[model samples]
Target: MRTSLACGALMGMWLGTALAEDDVESVRARSNPAQGYCERVRGTSRAEAALEWAPEVFASVGAVNAGVAIGGNDDTPLGSPKMRVTAGLGYDFVGIYRGRTLRSRAEAECRRYQALAALQGALARGSRLGETEALQARARALAEALPQAETLVSSLREELRDGSATLEELNAVQVRLDQLRSLARDTEQARARLGLEPAVAEGQDLGALLTAFESADDQVEALAGGLRRARAWRVSLRGGYDEVFDEILDVDQDTPLFGQLTVGYNIGHLWQGKANAQAREGRRQETRDAVDSAPRQVRQLLGELRLTEQGEQQRLREVSTLVSDLEGQLREVEQLETRQVRRFRDYLLLELARLKAEQAYLGAHLKTLQSLLGGVKS
Candidate 1:
């Protein structure tokens, strides 16, 4: 009786799931760019995964075939016969079989690495979007602060002419106000970089760049491991059993079992192994060269992040000083005369500047995190 119904049902379910995925693959691809790219990458890996087990399956069948043997001799007396059975297994430790086994293992490892890269790529897109939102918020707040900063600078100049503020103080305040306007303009440019419109590509963001680096690195490692396996010595082991009987000889044969171990070297494989090692080493060196260049690229990006952080800090300090000066002057004016409306406007201007500084700081902070994490994609 066959007892494979449960196994067959499970296999059917797995096949059904695979067919369902194919039907939905197109729809999912169209839903989002990241998902589409990830699906394509995984599809390629699935093909690799499918073939990776073929060598193992073939080897298993070969092992079973080696276990049974039978033979009978009829050249004896008419009523007598001789029978014999021998069983043994043979393993080719060197050559095609070993190479195929190694290749299969390498392919399996590469498939797993590729899958991880695809998943990370999808997550990276979300991280890029988060960076865009933070920068956009900073740009909007800075745009509102620009006019207020201009007004404050003009008021400082007027105070300088009235002998209430020194010439040096007026110049310093003017510089700070000009710097604020420049930062606002810079923020707008950063916003444009984050936009989806047709603009000059600034290459990939830090996340995507890092993702590419990691993927390449994984490839190099997989190839290096395969090269090592190709160069190493291999050993194979096997065992089997057989039984035979001959009634004509009035004798019954007993069952026998045997095992074998083989260790071999292939002269032709030596050159092939050397060639594979050289190829893998060449690729690994190439990837290492690229990795070496990454530090310079990352340093430049980190410098930009640092500059933005410093800008936010300076702007916050300048705004705080301006607010204190405005409050002190307004307090004296309120006691000597009534200029409540002007005082209120100056207070609002200072408050607005503070808020812009805070938003810009937050944006800069997000940018710093993005640079530091610097994963591929996001």
Candidate 2:
């Protein structure tokens, strides 16, 4: 449910825009967890006002040699030296018959705004995602280190019980393990605040993200259509009814209704249409290029992401092998007649090194994931 980013820890950290707190059930929630983009994209709309006509007035007078009034019978006044007067008042105005074209222009503007919002919102979310994932990686690293620290503390405690290790050394080891645990807990809580505690579902990865790129290509076609419609000129038509008030006719016969029709072309509007068509072509091409390049760029990013993950896997394997070797050396030292605490210290350091390596690799992998879906081209 895309609403506001006010609740997330990442809010106000990436971009100035924030999301609302409303949550809804939809596919949109998968891509926009904070709902910031969805709320902003909804601003595109159209507005309309009531129609009004320009006013026109007409007056005419003539010596009547028995002119028949409207709705007059044959017995009506005829052959009389009478002065006839008729005054017609009407409302008229030149209208460009391009209402559809005007609407198209409005819609085009709306889509452009939506595209801009999409781009900016994606960038903001991507930056936030990167930051949150980094926190999570740190938390995981501390978690791994905590257990190693605890194991070392337990071994020292046993030596203290055997009178081989001093209480001060055991207490120091316990304190280090407790510090690691406290740091890990704080990191996890920070990650949770950022909404990164429960990772995204597996299904919403590269496959779903690529589908979004295809959808963008479809929007280009719609934008082209909107631009074409926006460039068209509207034809003007003026038609209305006018009631005539005849002072002479009222004395002779009852006044009647008269209808007026006007037809005209707007050359200036047509010329403007030509200019608009040319201007709109440039926008059409720009939008098309933006949309067309999105999919290819996403595909390339996906490849980069895969490579990053593969590299991380290899590093994890090498680090794990080194940790295993160090453990085996510690065991060999334990079986030796000579007691050397150096071997145990080396094993602890090796474990810590392995944990740090895991942390680094996982952080890199998280950044790659963020790039894949965060709408960042690079």
Candidate 3:
């Protein structure tokens, strides 16, 4: 029988998780109209466009040279009165390096925007509408019980004046009633900001919710891309065809086309590149370390949240048991006025306790959900 009960409980939990998944999907579908608004507001669309066109933009950064030179002896020179026209093209490697860096930075921004969008979507779907409704109901119950509590306090004060009740008893009842009044007001205000929107059902599987938040290594990618660009800036290549036309030379003697290739390294930029590469490599290593440690950090956070949830659940159970006991006691002494008064007071206080316990448990549950869904922020 114990094994059967355990299996039944597990099956119920599984069903609850399945239902929660469906609820999440429903909420996501409902919120789809507002999706990507965050990215658009943040101007990531332009950054995305920049990333797409980065290669062509950088490839176009080059120099084209065209010149006319005339130099020859006017008298009996081999190519007197010679006029030469030259055209060539050259590129600077620094421009390519800068373009690559800009592209990497744009990619990093895009990744950050994606991460924020995911977080916002999770929050939108995980609305606290149900929790707010529950609080509103609690507020209504508190409101209805306030008059009864005031009547009880008045009777207690009269009893204290006639020496039928102690001052301590009167004060305790007054304090409890005051607490209930305050709690009622606070609960009423809790519903003030709630919107009428469907939300994912409570008791979602943490692992499943966590699947929505994947760790992003945008910083590492940017740094590594920078390092690559820095290392690549050491070498420069200039290859082009120069065309020259000489008026003084015959067609066979004229060098109409000359092909030249120049491969060179900037020793100055080599030193600069070494320094830049070292700095970028160091930064990349630091980012890599952080990314590697993120999983452990997330695990620690989730573990703490789970423990808090368990604690709140335990408290809710204890408060529920107390409320149940008080109800039974109140019913047992229905005909005894004095006993009923005392039992009723205890019941009212225990009812408040139960509500608070429920609130705390729900709060813990929400915290756990947010932590699991947000993961490590980018």
Task: Tell me the whole-model lDDT of each prediction, alpha carbons only.
Answer: 0.50, 0.48, 0.50
Q: Give the TM-score of candidate 2.
A: 0.46
What TM-score does each of the candidates earn?
0.41, 0.46, 0.44
Candidate 1 local distance difference test against the native: 0.50
Per-residue C-alpha lDDT of model 1 across residues 1-378, encoded as one tens digit per residue: 011442344345446544654555545455543444545555665565445323221122111122222446554334323444555554544435434544444554455444334433423343333354465556556556655566566776677788766676656556665565566556555554444322111223544544555465556455555645544655666667554345534444354665667675656665666766677677555644554444334534445555554665576677556667766665655555433444444545555465556556565555555544454321
Leading candidate by TM-score:
2
Q: What is the lDDT of residue 273 in candidate 3?
A: 55
In lDDT terms, which candidate is top?
Answer: 1
Q: Candidate 3 has which clashing residue pairs, if any?
A: none
Ranking by lDDT: 1, 3, 2
Candidate 1, residue 334: the lDDT equals: 52
TM-score of 1: 0.41
Candidate 3 accuracy as lDDT: 0.50
